[model samples]
Target: MSVPGAMIRCMDLTRFFADVDAQPWADLHHAYGSAADIPDCLRALAGESEEAASEAISELYGSILHQGSVYGATARAVPYLARLAGAGYRTEDLLVLLGGIAEGGADEGDSEEAACRAAVVGQLPLILAKADAEDPGLRRAAAWAAAMTGAAEQVLPVLRLRRKTETDPGVRAELLGAMAHLDPPGTAADATAAIGAHEPAEVRIVALLACVDGGLPWGPAHHAAMLSLLPVNDLVEGRLDLERNEPLQYVVEELLRRDTDADRDAAYTLLDGALRSADSEARAEALWAAETACLLSRSAPERLAGAVEAMVADPADAPAAYSLLAKLGVRAAAAAPVLARLAAGEGDPADRALEALVAVAPDRAAPLLARDLGRRPRALGAACGFLFGGAAGASFTYDPELLDAIRTRLAEAGGPGADEVVRLVNLLGAWGSRASAALPELSAVLSLCPGAVPKALVAICPPEHRGTTAELLTAAARTGPEEGRLAAAAAVRELTGETGPLRAAVAARLTPGGPAVREAASLAAGLGPEAVALVPALRSALSDRAGDRNIPQMDADVEIAAALWRITGDPEEAVPVLAGVLAEVQPMWLRWTFGRAARAAARIGGAARPLVPALEGLLTEPMQIPSAVLALHAIAPETLDGPRTAGLLLDAAEQDADAETALDALVVLGPDSLTEDGRRRLIALAERDLRVRASGLEPGIAPADERLREQAREAARTPAKP
Candidate 1:
């Protein structure tokens, strides 16, 4: 077959390096293992089928850049890969690989990333030429790659020109985005001008965001303008992507900004009408606005209660409404009767309603909960589901008699013969050490509920029962599936602070293995420094294993990296891997990504400074903002002084979802970092926190806000301390 421009370019790439078939790949290392497979992966991309190309890209991503950390082989491969990209063979995937590789290896763990990025950047012109390629997809991808790898100064002009001539809205958006990356506008006027310019919503939105990224002022006018761009038809039909919600979210956050009374009142009016809107999108967004207002005490909580409860009537909408209600705490007490009635119904609404009701109307909910618990022996599973179903349920005050009755019921129920029995047993397990009274009952069903049983036993056992718990854990470890065994290992480690017996199991599981490796890695992670002996094994597990035909869980490398950090106390060893994991996971923003790896990096204290960049990447994610800021402040306090980080925290504190976490990070920054804009941000955060408390919510974490405020003040007074 006659080679296309892409394959010819790829053929030229071979000259930049050893023949793919000739390279001694086994000696060269990647995240998972040797680099030998990389050549195969590289060759696989030259194949005709998309599947082969995709598989090759996937393998490359997994091995060379597992999660996000770059390996030695990755750096070696970039120049040749860039040539392939320049030639336009599998350009999008190549760019993705290049981008991922470029984002990594800045740390000691993955030392090759920096060199690889520089090499790739050196090939910028070839990749940039694709911006003018006849293929629009390649043009779009090339623009993104420029943003990801190429110099902003060199790429910006090209992007601007492309924006002028681009007919494709998507391509235009990408150009504007790439431009934004190069020199984002840095003032309210520039942002307004950029957004108000003749451009598609995607381009305009990117421009506004770029302005924020550029440390621009974003005030009520900007807020109002962003919201105004939301065409009504799109909102009602849910035609817009998740990105479109960013502007609406900003409007909701307008309450937290230091704005005029007129703006505040106008925002309230705008939000209130939206709250009343029948369209789910509008109402949902309005509810978010109302929650922030309520939390800030800028708007009355009651104003949004009816809308929330009405929204809750639909099962699909209930989870979100219940989440707000959970935040509302007792402020939504007036909705208690409504919640209780809803809980009496069935499925998700019942579970969420019960959880929310327990928070707002505990006294009112107790009887309803008691009724459900005793309603029928078969209803026991659903009843347990109601109590332990949502996150808020952990805080629910259980009636002593009901607890006693459930224990008694479980004792009489014997082994879990049904799915419901397994669930009930799991709930009893979740009750933890406080529910130790149910241990005997739980142990009886150990075989039936292998996964939950050992965890429960270890969690709930008294100090006196530690040996007994260890015994049971060992037994479970020997008897259950890989997950069950790991769970048992983690549990036993917790109680005994010993890893000797589990070391063999850990080594056996933490290898080039299957899906079960994830569970094993998680257990090792949870074991903390106690699993020190498994460090080498963990490192081996993290290596590329393309030869192995096993599908590991997503972010498996992250868990192993986190465990390595916790166990070894070696930031140089752990931080880069954690950062890599963060790089890999942050773009996805999965709820689970905020788990051990991020926490490990945060707790590693000052030595995890290398991870600051990775942590900062997550600052834009509302769910991740708190963790990101907290990690930043803990690892490198001085870094946040720069506008972008501080501005991000300030923005985070403005939102209801992230307020507590944002405040937590601010407090951690102490008074020194809290002065000036930092001080104002902390003050606003404190005020918002106080408003949440004053709203009569549970105040579970916010009362600590004042203490945090005082700590900052103390730091201010001390001034002598660094």
Candidate 2:
């Protein structure tokens, strides 16, 4: 076992572990608790068998560099790993592991991450020597490892030297990528130079990306270089471990990073050509890039929708095409004709086609959906208009045919699965009293699917049927499963304002260790003063912090606080809990918990004055603006800078970053707070054909945009009082 091109003598295997026993392994930690087992994993890497060494490296990755996270033990293991590679003990695998550790880097001011990088840097000599190894695989691995060191000064020169003689296009691509990573500006000209016709397709693909990464001007050469390499999958053959495996998608991402209209146009151009390509592979790659492009560029949905429609024309490609169209929402209305034709047919493809149709043109989709009910579960789920638990948009238009289909599906003996039952019932619930015809079917399923049926019954039953509905709900609440019982109690309360059933059910589920504590807290909040008797149970559950709860602890606390406020109207009990959540939650928590806490605090009115600073702090965050504004308006309207708040909301609206929330906030502020320019902007937003809420890659963008536009129009029409 000797190194082929070793510049430094490889240390003995025994000596590699000379100091291993001296380290306080038990005191150190990796991703999963103590580092005591790390010594065995390190020694296993030095084993003679490849299978054992492979497993050992994988185990080490899971522990030390778990999911790109580095730990104290990660730095300690670097020296032994370097020695193993230097000694030619699974050098390729060890180099890859070392590279991953280097790339994971460290958090700011984390000595361990810095130490891990420094440790890799310390072994630069042995690692760089392998860049010239005879095995192209080893050399490729070495290039990647060397680049990960971030010692551009040392690694770049060696990589450039290797580039002069490297024959493998895969290795050369890795080298170009490494150099680009080390210094994008310095490597831009080199990257551009490699895009010539003479370079292998693999090298040119990477060089083209380097130019994009370096912010080199997009011109004829770069454009031609990219177009010529359409469907780069064949040339690269998945050999190069590029960040994004698909070259076209990688290019779109890099182009979008520039985030200019010109860059977007450039991406659209590439996708358009590929979409029109006779080559199926090229079109397939374009489809992936199109989804990414549509989500990112405001102009993309219009530009790519036609090309995507063209892709949808192929039966083999229709499923994926329908998925992207669904995500584009109403932006893909132009494809409705094609979707309807396919949806008119049979089987999974038609079902998928109908699902997209429902998303983009629910009216067009409704008749087709009604015709195909009971068979197309996914399309029906789309028609239900709720994703997970949040309302995505308005449900499909009420149609006699569709209503009849739902009733038929519900009435069949041993009918749809629990999920389908839930979806059908939800659609009925969305229709309210118009779906009164389904009441018998809803009542029949109460015993079987009580969680969904009770709520739907509450919505569909008219005034005359309320007594019977409440009686049915009361019986279910008393006898059904925990989930069903809770839902029944809630419906009963909603119908008759009856506190007994709800209180009894809520009290049973409000125990500290109960599975439905969050649900119970929510129902308790809805009860308001009617739920006063449950205040003690709610308080106890607030501090429960049960580890197995479905919702986050902070979320449960916010719910309990809101419940306490509604039940007892005690600001002291609620304000501090809401404030603490606002103060302690991280930025990632802003999506739900922070907004929820702010809205909860808003309910306390002036009594929530203590939470004003916390709510104000959230004003700076784009996503939190709506909840914060609404809260501040309720709690302390006098302290707000109306013009500044208006400006922030307007900016968010124009950018579509948090447009819906911003628009809602503006509506609440009314026309009086708006400047003349703000009013003009609002009118422009309402009249604009392009969406105001088109930023996310989710499925409901089109409907959400329309909803925003309608709201904007309403806000603009609100007269300013003299």
Best by lDDT: 2
The stretch of ten residues in a row with the least summed lDDT in candidate 1 is 235-244
lDDT for each residue of candidate 2 in 94-126, tens digit (9 for 90 to 100)? 898898888887524658888888778888999
The CA lDDT of each predicted structure is 0.62, 0.80
lDDT of 1 by residue, 578-687 (tens): 66556553434464465445676778889987777777777667657767777766688777764455456556555444555555565565545544656555555444
* Candidate no. 1 TM-score: 0.55
- Global Cα lDDT for candidate 1: 0.62
RMSD of each: 12.1, 4.5
User: What global local distance difference test value does model 2 have?
Assistant: 0.80
463, model 1: CA deviation in Å? 20
Give the distance in Å from residue 674's predicted Cα in candidate 2 to where it truly belongs.
9.4
